[model samples]
Target: MLTALRLLACRRAPRLPDIAPVGHVVGCLSPTLLTSLASGHAWAGRLPSSCRVRVPLGDLQCVVYSVYAPLQPSTLSSTSTGPADFDGRAFLNFGTSAQLGFLTSEPPQQPSVRDHAGIDCFPFFSPDRYVLLAASLNGGNVLAEFRPNSGRLARAANRTAVSVRDCLAAVATKPASASDPDPLISPTLLDERCGGGTQGGSVLGLRMSSCRSLGRLYRSVCLGLINNLLSLCPPAALRQAGIDRIILAGSALRRNAVLRRAAALRFDECQFQSIVLEDGGARQQPAVADGAAGLAAQFLDWVAAGRGES
Candidate 1:
């Protein structure tokens, strides 16, 4: 229920002033639409209970609403209900008007990453729900679909690689980045962007910019991989939190295959049931086929856990 919901209290008169705030009247809206808008704000949590912010207008508090027609993931850190510009009060108090504007308008736009003020997770689902998808050395993409209606999905293997790269670079050079305090680009990610000027630092303008560029490159890679997955995967259960069993059904990894690469990364952490693709399907040596089968079983385990069927 809207706790602060109330009709406009006209100071001059109830005769309906020409410039009355929006909350003077907000009729019913389908909860489905509301849920979509509101639920879109949590990083795996609930939406704000009150859609409208109350703005004071010289003894006449204006019931301001918001209409961020395209509420970017970078924008919603403050409020619209109070004065503008560094009021020392939190942003939302002054942003009641933004809220009012958002609520009264006809379906605002989806929030972008920056709109959430460097916190892209909000106004979106749990970060875990977004799989870290990536293209295989082959043409196929490795991915886990997300179900908005279900549990969290595993982080994309690609994300893991990028993260690992970032971590290693941090340890090696401790460069700044989007996620760092003295945030600068890591030496490695920047080197790739600079076209191999990594050692002399000539290709890169500076360490900071290069680090930022690497973050952007990582995002670009992640997004591109996601697009590929959406195009390649089957329609049903494509958006769920994990891979369908069928993806593994025919995915026995060949030597130096895509599946093997993903599995090789995780081999130290997980055990595999060996099936050597090179040794006439014998377990003479660990092969890509072994990794694929093992990966398949692990993916199945994840799906089962997601469904509480394990």
Candidate 2:
């Protein structure tokens, strides 16, 4: 990726006249920044100074949550000349790793929090990691089966040809009744990375009717995931940073209406407005790529106006 970026910086193509040099190219490594840019919060000259953005991107191993906030003037070093100095953006990344011990039965220690350009950043851990395990236990692939078919399930609610994800969402979203009791699925999963010896995840309250119900199982998984996420970056902290809107961008939240709806319902209690990138009325396939392109365009404009010339 770096090599490709370097080549694009050094070699200017006739078709693309606004390509910035390598020195001027700003790399966006955080999902928070990407989601902020994709959601139209960041611009060439109008970067927000007092907004917070929360982004959760699901990776193969775990789900990563990135919270972006403007840099506090007090945190800036006199000699530092980094991108954060220019754009006033700083982010905290929390990865759902088993080592964090968030899923342990015992009360876990407080995650080490760092001050990053004013925003409080926490150590990495994967709270949503169990969702993947639950999917695997149910004999379904989370990435392949759940993510890909999420769009179909979200768009066409009445479609007959439902995917595994659709079925899970349907069952998960239904109101609980006497016939359907909620299952309890532990988010903890044992991994080599964990500090102490721990067992894998467990399922409880398995009734004859609910044992085979994937939705109930997944509902517990989703609740666990979202709750873990909120524990890391609570709405009170976001509001303290003057963030009223949260832009949800990621394969998991963007494609899965189930996850999106769950997240919306959960965050609604905090009174924070949420925006799903996929449901923005306009189609934004590959949102990160579009955001990167938009940033490049902004950089070109910034350079043309005697800024970002270094």
Candidate 3:
């Protein structure tokens, strides 16, 4: 990657002339694909069936790709140096898997790759801007499956289902339900966990306290993941970049009151406004995919007008 970047930098003596505009611009976002034959620094490569890149871009390609970050959905009118609200901004694609990043006017200085558990952090962007990004393998998909009815119910309920399992291990020993149960549990201990236990008749009551407890656990796991990612994004960097808002997107947040509450509290604590993407009369996954497609369309428009990289 470094070699390719160096080659690109050294090869160019004078700036390239403004490439003629093609018929249209090609735009895309994570988890969705759009395709076109025309190619240029301002336009993205062929779109994929999914929003993600099944084939990772080479370093040179990444450098070129960074040019598109500023053209993301919410930043259309944003100046090249910074948005009006701040010097930079962040977009958190909150989904079954989550990605958080900041848009910058320059390519990042360091190689952006790191691993926290199974999640991957890296840089993605077009030439005029960089996206400092971190992605998690865990997302709302696990939370959805964690429900008692899901096929992966056992796995989802397991302490190991989340990255913060160790943190909850000591606390999980408390019965899923008990009169003297932990505060996290509700008054009624009867729920699915009561099956085959000494409380034979408790399950008959159908008290949802146990289910609520499970939901709390899932929410905690989600919060931990988000918090961990935020911690990795240095405060100094955010302040320097003037990040004032956080835009959250994905299906994981739909019908997820707990996760949304946690995020609101955390962002408030950090003095940042949090904007939850609307459901748009659909589930979170479809809404996210549709949003990506819409953004891609706008991006293509932005590029075709010669508003992209110089």
Candidate 4:
């Protein structure tokens, strides 16, 4: 197994073209895959036992785990001076032996609140302003709710499902239950009477940095799907695909706690594995496994191509 990367850095560089950071960008695993990875010995970790939840970075709708690292300092001396001054660090990548490193300092204590647990300041969105959000990591069942109205998360109704799971096919359980209150944020909320004119809608949802309205469409289905995602998908199924790994911006996930628990559940038949490409990029076995790289590359390519249409 390869050690996870520690990409600690500070400051921004014009030479390093700004990349857009889309929320819930990809489903790095499937529920089944998650289960498989959890069975591996290398899946163990020193994750904070208790995580206080917090609102996600976007939409103010997401629920995530909040970790508090004791003695963790905010500022530290930089070890390298390439373009920015940063004290980078590495941690864990659920169920895998690889380290999850980012371009930031690894303090002795976790932050009381973390907008993003898996990743932060995505190069794509940090300076470039490309925001994306996904709801599931199941390769077959995934959706990318395009940010139609600025940075807010696209409600279940408006979100576009990608290669979603077969179970997600039951998308018509409820028909917009409009009278029930779309409690979650939606396009209609942007209306004047909705109290969202100047407040910036969901302060966190604005992470996308695009105010392009996708217009009203068949969004009721989204509500139904959300129900299914929360209810239908079994725990074992989530285990298979590396459940909860796929994060939706503003999604109310339990953070690293769920990930840690997932590993403790079972992990004998599984093993952590990774392969390095000639380009230096690595592919994990249990989590993203076989074709994740190819799938991701193609997905990004399509996104790049779609820009021409808009």
lDDT measured at residue 156 in model 2 versus the true structure, 0 to 100 = 74
Give stretches of model 1 more than 4 Å off.
1-168, 171-212, 234-310
Judged by lDDT, which candidate is best? 3
lDDT of 3 at 95: 63
lDDT of 3 by residue, 1-310 (tens): 9999998998876667444322222333444223333335355664444442222223322322222323343443322344323234565555666556665555345433222222233433222434556544445554544443432454566734644333234333432333623122111222122123333111223345535454445444555656645644544455555677776655555455556665666677888787654346543332433434444564556567776432
Q: Write the per-residue lDDT of candidate 2 for residues 148-231, one digit (tens) a residue.
A: 444464447655665665565676567656566577664544222212345655677878876555565566666555554454
**How close is each model in CA RMSD to the real structure?**
23.9, 14.5, 14.4, 23.6
My TM-score estimates for the predictions, one after another, are: 0.17, 0.46, 0.46, 0.16
User: How does each model score on lDDT?
Assistant: 0.25, 0.40, 0.46, 0.25
lDDT (Cα, tens digit) per residue for candidate 1, span 1-310: 3433433333334675355332232334455666766664653235344433221122111111111111121121122222222111111111101100011111122332113221111111111111111112212221111111011111242333234334323333432244433221222222222132434211223345435443333223323332222222222222221221111112223221323333332221222221222335542332234333333343345446563112
Better of 1 and 2 by TM-score: 2
State the displacement of the C-alpha of residue 64, model 2, in Å, after optimal TM-score superposition: 12
Cα lDDT tens digits for candidate 4, 74-163: 221111222322222111222201112222322213232122232222222122221111222221112233223212334454565432
Instruction: Show model 3 residue runs off by greater than 4 Å.
Output: 1-87, 110-125, 149-212, 234-236, 277-310
**CA deviation > 4 Å runs, candidate 2:** 1-162, 176-181, 188-209, 278-280, 283-286
Q: Is candidate 2 or candidate 4 better by TM-score?
A: 2
- Give the TM-score (vs. native) of candidate 1: 0.17
Total backbone collisions for each predicted model: 53, 5, 15, 61
